[model samples]
Target: MRISKEEIMDAAKKLEPRLIAFRRDLHENPELSLEETETAAKVAAFLRSIGLSPKLEVGGHGVIADVVGSTPGPTIALRADMDALPIMEETGLPFASNRPGIMHACGHDAHTAIVLGAASILVERKERLAGTVRLLFQGAEEINAGAKAMIRDGALDGVDEIYGLHNLPTLAVGMAATRKGPLMGSVDRIELTLEGRGAHGAIPDQGADPIVAAAAVISGLQTIVSREVSPFSPVVVTIGSIHAGQANNVIPHRAEMTGTVRAFDPAVRRQLPDRLRRIAVRIAEAHRCEAELRYIEQVPVLVSEDGCLAHAQRTIDWLLGAERHAEAAPTLAGEDFSVYLESVPGCFFWLGSGPSDRAEDAYGLHHPKFDIQEEALAVGSAALASIALLRGQSNHSLLL
Candidate 1:
């Protein structure tokens, strides 16, 4: 039998205190990407405490647990990231990070807590459940490596479908949003080095000014989005850092630059590297300098399968009322969760954690002061649990 909204809500309420405590503990002891040893241990311990045996170190600190239901049905996987950023904590909450230079600025702690809470609820209703629910606590999401590692380790070996959510601080609390097709863009890192002869600053003709070439290259890259790409297609080329000369009186031998590229369309993403390289090389040649471009394609665009998204939206509507859900526009930010979606049909949604009263509580993700409204814990947990239960029951069809 499928779990009802009321039942999930009640379970969430009863589990809220424990959920908050678990989230706080994770928040206090944040770990970095690919190095979530302690965090992985804690997650495994929590799963065991709830009578589930989890496989540890699946992919360098990733933890996976399976909760088999009373009967056979489609297996669904739920995932949460366990890594923190390099930023220092500025949110003066009592449970602020004890580890300096690391903080849960992206709400991964809350994601982990919500998934654990869902696991607890599912375990309680195991006898009524129709299939298995797999919990994936992933590491290194910040660096976009964890999901791939987990998949390599066979996290999705028997998983029929997958689901995950990120906390959106801008969305009002008690709400959720998702949509079909591309929900998040692909990310590529670009590095360029312009080589030129060094000479005294006073002798303009003696040296090839790579700094000038670098400036032109940066300007030229901007035109790729505005002129080369379709205006309707979203793409971004941002030069985040540039390093040239050390002394004011001397020309530098080389100028180095690093930036990122984001695109939602696959065609646009595939052509970015060649276009950027062409732009850099031609611009550098114009200034009598040699250019080397390194473009590393990272994560792919996160697309939601049509059926999975419909199911997720229906589940959210049922859990929080139809009025509480919205169709989220595609975002440029990249998520490693896209890795898992590549292997399985799934939907990744956004859970609203923004506060209604305090503007400070709406601090965006990755900001030092970023935080989620604790009440979102219950909303996310209940929604996730409801989705799993509904999907697990073979006879249950979404009331869309």
Candidate 2:
């Protein structure tokens, strides 16, 4: 039996106070990636308080638990990232981060709270559920390692499907968005070291000048996106960091550059590293320097399966009305949730948290002032609960 929309909404509404409290507590005491021991403890305690036994430290501080149904069926896993970023809180929202350099700038606090709220709602309707709801409070999402760690520890061992959400500051409160496939991009890192002879800045012939080679390599990297790949296939090659000489006059012996590459197509993603390596190495050599490149594949593109995406769409429409659902545009931002989707059929969606509904007016994720609308908490909780409750069921089961 599927739980009614009203029941889930009402339960989420009733739990708002506790949800806000839990979210605020998490916001005030944020922990960085792979260091969420206290956060996991609190989540586990909350699960235990609701009479569910959660497995602690599943993947270096990840917390996992299940809300079993009266009848045996497929297990639907709901995930929440628990780690914060390294930015200092500047929101001044009364419950700003207590940790000096750690902040919940990515809304993982909201995600964690929303999943906990869903757990509460699911527990109350446990007898009516046709399947189990697994709760995954993952750590280190900022580093993109949490999902892999949890999966390695068997987080998806018995789970047939999974679902999760990230709060979007641009999406307005009371609204939700997702797409059928390729919702987010894959993230890869590139590190290039250019080696050249060093000499006095005044004498150009005396030194190879790796700094000049670095400049040429940087400019050459952009051509791969514009000249090599198809304009229709989106790809981003960003050289975010560079280091070279200590003194202004003396030429540096070595120059190092680090960057990020994002793409949507798997074929495009696979070709980026080779293109980058060739461009950087050949360019540096042309400038009389030797180049060494390291390309690290961080996360794969996030594609939402049609089945799970349809369930999420129906759930959102039923709970918040058809007007609240949106066909979200694909983003180049990387999410570790994509890792879970790779292991099982699942959907990762956006929960509107924008105060004015205009995302541009608000700070984006990873910003020092990044935050979400508190009202989105209950909406997200209800959406997550409704999705799991209606899993493997027909569209006619929706109250709408």
Candidate 3:
């Protein structure tokens, strides 16, 4: 049941220019999370061109196109996110984003293009395959809604296993990286509201000011990770934004602050919000003010299946060899695709997309200037298609 890797590579190479154009087009006309109207339409058109009946608007711009093989076997799903970031492109390329305040800085455009290229090849080789293949184009990944929406819409109807990939700017091209577990961290949002009486700047004891209490609460949160959480595990609590007084002379009665908590294990992930609430309330009580704390779970940690990534990584090694590949370093950043891992055994890896010339200074994903090297498209497509077809000796259970 060996697939023609050479044929797959040839097809991918032939489709490289179109894939680049699609990526650039998606980059030029980037759409925000959950609002991928144009992007979805373009994907649908491309699928249709490749003779796939793409179901549109599934899970708010998420799309699925299935390819059924000649013989019944298993359902393996390949997913790609299509949503863009709110960043404005600054790459200065000819196909730079025409839309302001929106860009595919995350390399989702490359993900979509590679998935589309794989779709073209998979359709051609559909009859030779033994099972079903699903191409999942998800939207709203940046906002953490698309994956859930797709699941609610039954994106995993016949899926037995799923796989997805992302681009890594720091890694050099021709390399891919993955791991066995906890590849990404869980993400949750928390907010603190401090309430106090407005006070004049010159008054020493006129009223209780929440601004002072909030400042204490913010600083107090720092001790949670250093003193409370275990040093062995990585935990991050960051206050990204704060809003308080508008005037210089008077202290505002209400001060609001929002921050994020990230951890790999569920125990710590749950502990963070509770600890934040306790910390803020105690700090505010000391200042004669009251604090309200709220925690919202955003995305779960991305845990790669044990031995599952090894097979995919082997496929990558066959293509790129060992020299270019590097082991992926864990990050506190979160991905909603963790939701998919909840239901099935799978792994999400990163394809190195930066140019070798400026690998040290390559622009990172989610940055306005983030742009991938064009050659990475063919590399990604060939790797994805090959891995999807390469069922290793360890896949005995999956085969049966």
TM-scores, all models, native as reference = 0.97, 0.97, 0.96
How large is the C-alpha RMSD of every model relative to the true structure?
A: 1.7, 1.3, 2.3
By lDDT, is 2 or 3 better? 2
Whole-model lDDT per candidate: 0.91, 0.91, 0.85
Model 3: residues with Cα > 4 Å off, grouped in runs: 392-400
In angstroms, the error of model 1 at 64 is 0.4
* Model 1 vs. true fold: TM: 0.97
- Pick by TM-score: 2 or 3, better one: 2
Predicted structure 3, TM vs. truth: 0.96
Q: Summarize candidate 3's per-residue lDDT along 1-400 as a digit string, tens digits.
A: 5555567778899999999999989988899997899999999999999888999989988889997777776788889999888787788999999999888889899999999988888788776666788899999999888899999999998788888899888877777888766789998888889999898878937878898998898899999989999987889889998898898998788999999999978778877877888999999999989999999998999988875687787777766677766788898899989999888878799898887877769988788788888888888888877666654223422221
| lDDT accuracy of residue 22 in candidate 3 | 95
lDDT (Cα, tens digit) per residue for candidate 2, span 1-400: 5457777888999999999999999999999998899999999999999999999989899999999987676899999999999898788889999888889999999999999999999898888777799999999988889999999999999999999999999888999998987989999988889999999999979899899999888899999888999998999999999999999899989999899999999999999888999988898889889999999999999998898888888778888989988889999999999999888999989999998547659898999999888899999999998888888455546353
Ranking of models by lDDT: 1, 2, 3
Where is model 3 poorest over a 10-residue stretch in terms of lDDT?
391-400
Pairs clashing within candidate 1: none
Window of ten residues with lowest summed lDDT in model 1: 391-400
Count of backbone clashes for each model? Answer: 0, 1, 0
